[model samples]
Target: ERPNNSRFSSCSVGNISAVLDAVRDGRKRDCLKEDAGAFCGNKIVEVGEECDCG
Candidate 1:
């Protein structure tokens, strides 16, 4: 479960899911995942990424 950060304090469940999905896919959108939580960093095929939620 994600902490109630100010960034997502006002987001709905669906919205949060969408953000998580984008991060999981290593996309550069949604909350600037690449900036801090870039486990995959657009390299989805690479292993060990697991998740990215920044």
Candidate 2:
């Protein structure tokens, strides 16, 4: 986990499974599987914690 960094954390994942699910669930607009978590900066895929609530 990224532990939630104020400067925008990331959940970098080698697998594209999560990305596919996001797209199907409408949580994500669109992206390239080859890009991995490089699609968006605010994406949860890159920000594993995204400034953890805790």
Error of 2 at 26 (Å): 0.2
How high is each candidate's TM-score? 0.32, 0.31
Per-residue lDDT for 25-45 in model 2, tens only?
Answer: 988874754544433445445
Give the distance in Å from residue 28's predicted Cα in candidate 1 to where it truly belongs. Answer: 3.0
Candidates' C-alpha lDDT: 0.59, 0.55
- Model 1: which residue pairs collide? none
lDDT of 1 by residue, 1-54 (tens): 346544544457778788789887887455753555435546454446565433
Question: Candidate 2 clashing pairs?
Answer: 9-47, 10-46, 10-47, 11-46, 11-48
How does candidate 1 fare on TM-score? Answer: 0.32
Runs in model 1 with CA error above 4 Å?
1-11, 29-54
